[model samples]
Target chain A: MKTIFIGAGNVAWHLAMLFFKNKNVQITHIWSRNKENAELLKDKLDKNIEIYHSLDSLDFSKTDADLAILSIADGAFESVLSKLILPKNCILAHTSGAQPMEILKLANYNSIKNIGVFYPLQTFSKAKEVDFSSIPFCIEANNKEIEEKLTSLANQFSQKVFQVSSKDRSILHVAAVFVCNFSNYLWTISETILKEKNLPFDMMKPLLEETLQKALEINPSNAQTGPAIRNDEKVIEKHLNMIEEMNLNSNFSRIYKLMTESIQQK
Target chain B: MKTIFIGAGNVAWHLAMLFFKNKNVQITHIWSRNKENAELLKDKLDKNIEIYHSLDSLDFSKTDADLAILSIADGAFESVLSKLILPKNCILAHTSGAQPMEILKLANYNSIKNIGVFYPLQTFSKAKEVDFSSIPFCIEANNKEIEEKLTSLANQFSQKVFQVSSKDRSILHVAAVFVCNFSNYLWTISETILKEKNLPFDMMKPLLEETLQKALEINPSNAQTGPAIRNDEKVIEKHLNMIEEMNLNSNFSRIYKLMTESIQQK
Candidate 1:
């Protein structure tokens, strides 16, 4: 199917590459307000793909395409969808994990018949290309026919595609924030601590890998480890003392003690 | 040279199994206060290795072992070392990361002409066996001769032997607590938050893997990701509210805010 990707951000870039990888789906046009970024990505693509400056500048009303992918930031979907001047029947989809399909409701895009969600539930970095096989795509559409079409398109890139409801996607997204956003923050916390000690972050890498492997092996509940659960007051005290000496972020000691107490609640 | 494993703790069990994997070392005996645990590990061994319940109970002083690896608890080491009567010049090593070699000097064990440390700088759970070949063994010896023998013995089990002074080892241990122990606590905090929000930790695995992989590929200072680091105050507020709802350890708010602030500083 002929397609157009609507952003030059991480997710847009990676998904565009995935679509490009499949000889079946053609990413005909790429758009970003920052034309340079769009052009940079276009340089990596097959010559057949066109590059555009922005959705506002694209003449979607006259363009003939099977589908248009909206991979822009959240809360900006309305503005882009309003700007698209496509026919009422052309498929339109936005890839926001937290936002619902209703966000794309448009009687006419100049009149697009279908609006759907193609939420790929993974964090993507513009600088770092990601593998889609491991990413779960959450699909939702205003209509069944559109959902089926979206699912087929999603399956072209990823191994798994789920027809998820808005509520479920929201749950999934909130969970992603905890797992991805907050978990990355945990690494930030480690980096802060290690830097204070003049220690290399490499020292933490093996342990981090092992922790991920173990958490996957067992139930996260059962997989939990450390002095907090064991209620080892001795080590906890020592750690708090060290935290003080490091003169770290003020919250570290309190967090350590709070977690120690939380886990100690037998 | 014949060798005896004098403890059945995490370190002892793991080291003994690895030593037996080597053809040069003889794991003649596995001694521990918990005889059942020792026997349990011994049964995992292919050969008929001996298991002794106590220091005096083992009559293997007559065995003329070249080295005795005192892998017991720190509190138990001095007494055990004092009791073990090896040949007057037998090499002795302890596996405690924090405890100094001077503890062995005080015991005055007859065979202890040499005192050294063979501290494997990694966390080992009793149930899980570690692949020592990849582990970094940090060694410190009283003299050059002892360092050479310890290096050779350590190399048999591991690819990397860091000739670390006790001072460096102590710093490494402190750094380890920051990574392993502190990181585990973060996992607990994240898990508790997830459980309260009716989410499964399974979803976090991909994010966890990606986060670790990114840190390895990029400098951690540049690898920072999350609301705090991004200065996304709205999401931070939402998370802080979520933490308040779960009563997810007071540390979560402080840690959450502090981490974000630290990243902002960077």
Candidate 2:
């Protein structure tokens, strides 16, 4: 199958690379707002692939493909779609867990027919190597035929694939924010707390990794341990006092109290 | 070296097993208020380890050892320490990250000469198999000789060992709360969000694991992603509205906003 990729960010970079290596897939073109990013992505893969600077000036006929994958940022979807023109029957899919396939349908009101979502539930970094086969791919489309095609395509990249509705995908996105983004922010807090004490952040590495592994081994509720879960008011008070004494953000105390309450309620 | 394990809780169970396996060490006695817990711990390992129901009832003459590790809860530390009777030179230590070595020092003010902290920084579940060799063991003592002996014992079970003061260990404990307890609570919230949507929590495993791996690969601040870091007020607003619409915990929305603002500030 022939595929045209849009965007050159982390998601696009990884997805494009995965598709480029597939024997049955051909990346006809890669487009990004910054020509330099597009060139960088192109330069990382087969140099023969076409590259475009803007979706508005693209010659769809010259780079026409069976599929067009939109891997741009969630906020840029509508604006980017406003400038796009695609050949008839070209399947349109996005890699955003937060966006629905209807956004693509609405954007292409009369010009597009087949639109879908191909959300991969994994965080990507351009500098790291991602084993795509292990990541879960959530695919959805307006109809079964398109969904089946998308599912087959996704299956080529990953062993774990599921058909999730737009509503469910949005819900997943919120959860993803908690597990990935919010938990990560907690790590930053951990680093900050250690930094102030002149303690090595490396000291927490084994504990951090073990905690994550513990969650997978059993229910997180069962795995939970600390002053909050134990409801040790003395330790909790001591921590809060220390936070205040250290002149840290008030949010730390707020989060600590709320989480402790939640764990106690559970 | 010989040791006496006080409290047959999760930490004590794994630790006793480690000591029980070491050719150079002998677990002289295992004490727990609940005889059943002590017996269970004993049954899991060598059958010869003595079991006791209370520190006050423990016959220290028959079970005297070079080291006494109080693995009981922080709340019970003082009460338990008040009941203990040991040989003059027997070193006393605790397996708590929050409690200071001074508690032991104060508890045994007239009788005890050596007090220290031997805190293994990992969440333990009795049912799970824990490989202690990789876990970080933070050791601290009132004197250099006691500190060296405790460090030597800790090194037997773990390669990652550090000599941290009671003050610094307390600081490390607070940071650990953010990384382990608070982060696990975030996982609980993620599970709740998915459960309300009738979605399987297993679907999030890959994303959860990848997020943790990313944090370890680079600084969490640099690894941060999602609408909050991007300062995409639109997506953030949409997520908050969705949380409100679902009638989930108000705390969820509160946490979402606070975390978003915190990430943006950084």
Candidate 3:
């Protein structure tokens, strides 16, 4: 399969590298609004993959690729989609958890024959390596043929593939926010609190690791602990008072109070 | 070194097992309110370790032990300390992160000569085996001699031992809540959301593993992502509308809004 990547960001960079390494698939073109960014991604792989500075320059009539992947930002989806010119048989897919598949169809309703979603339900960082086999790929398409084609493509990288509807994927994205992004913000707050006292953030390493391990092993509801879940009002009050004394910011106290109340509600 | 354990809870059980395995130290006695609970802890190790149903039953006068550890609940610390009568030369330590060492001294100021704090900064579960070498031990004592003695004891189990003051440990405890307990609650909420959509919680494994790895690798503030930190109001609005549409408890929506606002403020 020959594929054209529509973005040169983290997701596109990772996917392009994956496809380039797999003998069965080939990355033909890499596109980004910035020429330097496109070249950076292209430089990571073989010289055979073409780099494009603008989507307007690509003539669908001149390309042999039929699989075009839009791995751009969610906000840029519609704007980038409007500028795209693809072969009539091209299978167009966007790698977004929150965006719906209908947007792809609505963008070029008359011109495009295939529209799908190839969302990888995992956080991506360009500096780190990802084991694609463990990452879950949520695939969706307008038709059975496209669904099977996308599933087959997903199977090359991951064994965990599901045909999730747009609605379910959106819900999954929200849940992912709570687990990945919001939880990360909690770590940031932890770092801030520890830094205020000149304590090392590394002190929380073992606890952080064991917390995740326990959650994976048991239901998180059963795995809950600490002052909030324990209903130790004294400790909670003391912590709040200390936070008040520190005068770092109000969000720390707010988060502590709200989460405590939420846990108690459960 | 002969040590007497004053509780048979999760922390005590794990600590007792660690002491029993080490050739340098000996667990002289295990005490719990319920006789059966004490016996259960003793059953996991050698029978030579005596079990006590009450602190008053075995006279501290008859014991050759100089190190008595109070591994009981934070709420019971004062009550347990008030009842204890130890030799003048013995060192007394309580494993609590929030409680101050002064509380231990205040309970029986004239009766006790040495007071200290030995806080193992990790969550413990009875069924799980923890690697003692990696767990951080926060040591505190009233005198330098006792502090060094406690540090030597802690070094037997872990290389990561630090002399933390009561105020700093209290702050560390609060920081720990954000990283461990509060983060675990986030996972619980995530599980609840995914379960509502008939999605497997296992789908979040890769993301959870990577989230922790990234946090440990760099500053979490630099590692922040998703709609919240990205300030993607469109996706955030979509998520809030979906939560409302699901008619799930309003807590989900509230958390979404507050966390998003908090991230934007950062």
Question: Docking category for candidate 1?
Answer: acceptable
lDDT of 3 by residue, A142-208 (tens): 9999999999989999999999999889988999999999999999999998998899999999999
Clash count, candidate 1:
8
How far is A243's C-alpha from truth in model 2 (Å)?
Answer: 2.5
Q: How big is the positional error of residue A218 in model 2, measured in Å on the Cα after superposition?
A: 1.0
Clashing pairs in 3: none
- Candidate 2 local lDDT, residue B9: 86
Summing lDDT over every window of 10 consecutive residues in candidate 2 chain B, give the lowest-scoring window: B55-64
What lDDT does candidate 2 reach at residue B248?
78
TM-score sort, best first: 2, 3, 1
Question: Which wins on TM-score, candidate 1 or candidate 3?
Answer: 3
Q: Model 2 - which docking category?
A: medium
Q: Rank the candidates by DockQ, best first.
A: 2, 3, 1
lDDT of 1 by residue, B115-160 (tens): 8888887766764545666677888888899899999989887777
User: TM-score of every model?
Assistant: 0.82, 0.94, 0.94
- Tens digits of lDDT, candidate 3, B1-266: 78888888878888889888888888888778868879998898878988877757534646878888888777677667777766667788888789998888745566578899999998877766788898889999999999999999999999899999998899899999999999999999899888888888888888999998988887687788898776788999999998888886778788888888998999
Ranking by lDDT: 3, 2, 1
Q: Is candidate 1 or candidate 2 better by TM-score?
A: 2
